[model samples]
Target chain A: LSINQVNEMEYEDFISTFGNVVEHCSLFAAAIWSQRPFHGVKQLHKTFCDFIDTLPKLGKEGILRSHPDLAGRIAERGLLTTESTKEQLAAELNTLTPEEKANLTRLNEAYKTKFGFPFVICARDNKKAAILSGLEARLENETEKEVIQGVEEVKKIAFYRLLDILQHEEAEKLIGGW
Target chain B: LSINQVNEMEYEDFISTFGNVVEHCSLFAAAIWSQRPFHGVKQLHKTFCDFIDTLPKLGKEGILRSHPDLAGRIAERGLLTTESTKEQLAAELNTLTPEEKANLTRLNEAYKTKFGFPFVICARDNKKAAILSGLEARLENETEKEVIQGVEEVKKIAFYRLLDILQHEEAEKLIGGW
Candidate 1:
């Protein structure tokens, strides 16, 4: 929906549409707007920052529940993706030099052991080489910090995607002016 | 590591430790210097943002590769300590009336179908009731736009997390001067 529509939405409707955006992004902060009719995007941005600052304090149970189970084929394959990449990653997985494959396997195991989850990176934008390099480098991070940093990295990639989706000048103006 | 240690490290080392951060959160912009050290927190912050603003435009594939997976369980569960209410979302999810659960389920499916992914909200500091209410509202967003907004929310959350991890300022100087 257009920003104009968003602005004009009934309090309930606007909140609903906006909330879905927040939910899909895993943004708990923006979804919980204490007051409606946000003064403007600047106010909204400030509120957004204040909310994100508190995520690290969540205990282990909270963090675990926050993660989705990577079950079934997805568990084996690592993640779901477009058909092309699925084929590409599969092919690359096959062709890895025995050494490269071993390193990847080692990196993968180290990453999971350190972080308590798969070493997930947004492979969409990266080539196989860059992905491997990133995987190797991140394996060195102490688990606590890596977990925090990895989540943030995921958030950044998600934002770029959001900008792509929203062509609304008003939304841009909201962010730009803010 | 302490902010002091971060400051003491060579430029390349600093980048290595925090490069992923700059890569994902700082807009993919980099400023390479043959022989200049980041002298202080203010200088570092400015350089970081400058580089971020200069990030090369990413292609669709590149953009897609940038985002990490959403914290689904976190969105559905977790305690939003940042909010005054200190809300527990999992409990709220459990308490969802049958109708609410159905709507959420439908919304989740619709959101994923349209966006090619599940709805992601950065629920670091929100109350559970607020999130559920938001999920109910946002499900109505057009598929494309909702995804866009979700990514943006994710970016803002990531930026905040970056600052937390890279504490460039000396606490005494930061607070005392402020």
Candidate 2:
């Protein structure tokens, strides 16, 4: 839709259109609903991000914890969002060996025990081996460092998600310059 | 931070420690502060994720939108979070040619115009060519399909980020089955 079309959308219409961009977080779309006339996808993304930055700490954490673990039971049961399912499949998380699955479960348990949250990471960016090593190495971090690290990882995930929803072909154009 | 230690932490301490695991969202830790005696990281992660699933749509979106763009202006300016910086670097987004940078800008702008969000993808999972091609190809998707696609990409990123922060060495053990 054009900027004008977006600017003119009703709250429900806008939310319906953009709500799932953030997973289960439609409120983000609603919050930005009033801030229409977005110059383009960048402005819209900025508006959404700005609002997130302004949220209370509690609100922010709530958002962070919303994501399910990679290769977790939720994912196995096919309960994850459609986007999540495909991403995991892309990463071959859906095809872990029995031994690999057991290993992930153990490491995931250990990481959470040390950090008090799931080990958050952008799985698509990593092969299973890298992810395993990462999980092992990060276990040594202090709680403070891990939290900061987790949040940063979450941001990367969100950025990619935003790109997916926006369907920006320019991603290649931006990178290739071909 | 063992379950016992986590149970014993003050609210402020808990949030301070685990708050950033979800980017700027700290409320996740806070909400689950009282749900101590977590069996392990998997349980802790589960608890946090379960709480998130229950959040209003707006809250979820806030979390989703908290991320900065991959190789976007923020990353270019080195303003992205530490975790993000490292992830982008891993994908070699930091080394784009000037022409590539301009192309990214163009693609980003076009994507946002159509979908009202940034173009998100797991940079680490892709080389520049793949990313560019992905951007080009995905532009043809309907908005609804794209939103689902976008969120899946975000999940992949988060999964990798989780691995980065948690640092589980058992990854090798699991892979090696040593």
Best by lDDT: 2
DockQ for the candidates, in order = 0.02, 0.09
Candidate 2 has a DockQ of: 0.09
| Candidate 2 CAPRI level | incorrect
* lDDT by residue for model 1 (B92-113), tens: 4556677766666776556555
Runs of candidate 1 exceeding 4 Å displacement: A7-30, A35-49, A59-106, A122-125, A168-178, B1-178
Summarize candidate 2's per-residue lDDT along A1-178 as a digit string, tens digits: 4556778985546766776555455557755775767876666777777766655444454454555677987787878887777767767887789999999999988876765567777766777888888888988899667766766666555556655655456343332221
In terms of docking quality, model 1 is incorrect
- Candidate 1 lDDT over A68-148, as tens digits, reads 222213434755333323433543544566677667777766665565555545444555577689888877888677666
Question: What TM-score does candidate 2 get on C-alpha atoms?
Answer: 0.49
For model 2, the stretches where C-alpha displacement exceeds 4 angstroms are A1-4, A167-178, B1-178
Q: How does each model score on TM-score?
A: 0.35, 0.49
Candidate with best TM-score:
2
How well does candidate 2 score on lDDT at residue A37? 76
- Fnat per candidate, as a fraction, reads 0.00, 0.20
